[model samples]
Target: MPSSRHLIGELESANLLGRGGAAFPVGRKWRAVAERASGRAVVLANGAEGEPLSLKDRTLMATRPHLVIDGALLAAEAVGAPDIIIYVGAKHRAAEAAIRGALAERSNQLRSRVRMMSAPDGYVAGEESAAVHFINAGDARPTTTPPRPFERGVDGRPTLVQNVESLAMAAQIARGIDANTGLVTVSGAVRKPGLQEIDLGWTFSDVAAAAGGLARPVQAVLLGGYFGAWAPVDEVWALPIAAPSLRARGFTLGCGVVHALSEDACGVDATARIMAYLASQSARQCGPCLFGLHAIGECVRRLAARSPQASDLDRLSRWSGQLAGRGACKHPDGAAGLLGSALSVFADDFAAHQQRRCLRRSTSHPASLQPVAAVA
Candidate 1:
């Protein structure tokens, strides 16, 4: 596609927001890079949505690679970048192929302008800073940031690093029209497990309906990815998917993967499994992360072993806040986010466990939602 300012205008008009789980404004991020004096800039499309329960990124790269690449190119043009990078998990071969195919079919100029880098598949590895570190010869782990990617990135140059869905939304915005919302991959206990693009401000019920409704009566909803919130189905019923609303509710419209569990699923056991996965995914660079995650995991294991004691619950609560902002990365914070929400929404469950009488006992669902390995 020819370079054009109209593309930027289109994004601004469409309100084509970023869908990178964070839901940051693409227009604002573009302006940040556009104002930089570094002269050299780059765009990185982060397709490593490491949420094991979510397939939105892989689906997008598999079926709509051109749109994402087009968005990346548009971002590059807006920021005056001559180069663009598509960072994907190594294991997503289908997505890699789709991106390759999309690039091959494009003009030689477009093809030559973009580079695809497959990152090691790990949860923390997909964070923008981590991806940047990996691209710059460091390990695929997040580095402490005062110089965030927008300020200094990709060999100390200004960069726009966004999720694959964010870039794809930008591409759609480049088409000069507003999309109602964006795509989401809703799995777990849903009648249909797939990706669907819906209008903004839709409720959880709307998303669930699009997915062909629940396979069984819903017990609770895990909105976002691994480190997201858990709410009773009732609380999530009219819940809007927009970041603002979700945040207001003490939740986030994260990676757009809502895992609705049935009444048969034990919340405590589920929490244990997820915590175990988070602990394992740590890059093991920071003390708080390495030890805190293990400690938290051990705590969950205790809870699962029998229900946590009232004292145990109190201890978990205290540690949740302690670890919230102490880590080098957001791993602890995200873990805290998920755990805190679990504590709040599943208060009864925690209490029941404390009494050694959980409402549900089934552990049929896997212990973890982490992909077997990082996708790279």
Candidate 2:
């Protein structure tokens, strides 16, 4: 039998929001699927977060798959969907096993209802619409919106897709956890770089402390992921991690990613590296995302290679805005957000570069921006 609708009713009253990068209200998404015509609907836990620097989704699935699956089950019941799909990244073997094991341990009623599928290893493949396409024998690139997942999804049925962390949060809400916190995997220069559950009202300082603080004096902090906010370390310490508050600061919660940059770290170089990675991850379906992200990455590369001209900076900012909302998915918007934040956070470096000076470390290669795991 389906879990009690009364339990789902309790979840609805908690005002839970998706902990995914998009942060949609979970109850609203439930309503969308629930009210669809009497045909079948589906629920997906997107554990395919392929961004190498961000590990929150994988961590959730690996360590707490039951929470994710229970949440998925609740979502499926709420929407009257007979099937549940837990989509995991190809490389997330640990996560895949956790989901399988958790399902195996469940009653036959639950075990028979859910299917775990692996997706191609690409960053954009985890996007909701893209996941629907991949599941339907189409390529893993995102399609044009308005025929969005909620309206027409997997096999032409309504689908409610959410990130693993978001589903886990829903489970917490279903269980009536008050002031439910979400997980952020803090990495990079922090002394501890692991998944930490923090209340929404907590400041960046609290997260940093949870991650064992910085390894050295910090120059800046990157919130979210590759497509995230770049703030002076001091300034970010004042900002809370909640979606609404962070959005008011023009930031996306971005799948619970928090990266700290050390004093010796070059924000300009780090930004360039991440941009290059994002460019490489493009599924190449839309012309704008395919061309625009590579172009942005190329510009960042040139700036890091030699002193960039003031014109170079202006050109980057201009292109950044042009690419903001022009793609089939949020890829362009993510790229623009990262670029804009880099421009704002690396102002001093941009100035120095424009004046014909380099600001990179003498002994280290630029790739040190790769994150490290947090110790307990």
Candidate 3:
């Protein structure tokens, strides 16, 4: 068994970052829990991928359950945590079965310490705070931060909520291997839409090729998920997909989602639909998240339908600024990020939509806009 200090050193050398959207350093998070946890801590493997465009977590859970479990156990040992919980979305039947079968293979002591739980099928259900709150109380809504999960979570004990993909990488790091590749889910207008293990430094075109190339001529790409930013196809095709590289360009490889839009798709219409879906997923706890998202969604819809007033765009810009950082959670901020990027990245498309002259009849069916209850 590796000491907590040794494990942190190994992770730091491997440069293993969290595969979650935040891209936080995994080693630092582990060290924080190790030092701050006063008593028995909780290790939670978060496989409840609330991002609709992302399937990598479910794929990892179902296909590589052992790796995820190994990582969780390693984390448990590192933090001196006795309890481990694998949280999956309620509808993820295959992943649940895989995890349960894997858990059955462990020793009685290990099995006794590990368990599984079903997460609510909502976008915010996968948020770290929301997951901690759900495990502590019955509600899955996010709470205000200050005493973060690592500080106080799960019955007032420090908790470590890690993404499943991050755990899989940690499993590799435990075996003296450095973190190199990551799981990516490439979908939408692709010839072969599926999950692929990609090298960290690979370019966007490399990712596209792993999915057998684009099924149609590409117009733009949503680099992350619904809460992520968009980039023109030409601008990002050759760009490296690594977090640092993308972050330098003011973007992230958020949840390893790469959704491509076909040349014939209407960006304005797609953005409007996605914004509306995000609005519906709000917890309704904060005024900015509930009311502000609704207002922005409506405005985007009107713009998509070419029925917006002259000042609609200006109002959207202003409201996005107002809604950001004002909510208890980052729900409002994520919506604002999506809307702001759409306005900037697809300026021509939005302008055309406002003039009732869409470039192409939209053939895009963004998975991000699908009803959460309908996904499995």
The best candidate by TM-score is 3
Could you give candidate 1's per-residue lDDT for residues 1-376 as a string of tens digits?
3244556656666666677667677777887887892558888899877778777788888888888887788788787888798998887899999898888788576832788888887898888889999999858888887799888989888888888888877776566456667777777777777777887779989999998988877788888878788888998789887777888877776787777877787888888888889999988988988998898888877877774655787788888888887777888888888888788877887777777777775755642242322223
lDDT of 3 by residue, 173-271 (tens): 888776989988887778787788999889999999999999889888887889898888898999999998999888888898888888878888889
314: Cα error in model 1, Å: 1.9
Cα deviation of 162, candidate 2, in Å? 1.4
Worst 10 residues of 1 by lDDT: 367-376
Q: Give per-model TM-scores.
A: 0.92, 0.92, 0.95
Q: Please identify model 2 stretches exceeding 4 Å from their true place.
A: 1-9, 37-39, 307-310, 360-368, 373-376
Q: Return the top candidate by lDDT.
A: 3
Between candidates 1 and 3, name the one with more favorable lDDT.
Answer: 3
- RMSD of each candidate? 2.6, 2.6, 2.2
Better of 1 and 2 by lDDT: 1
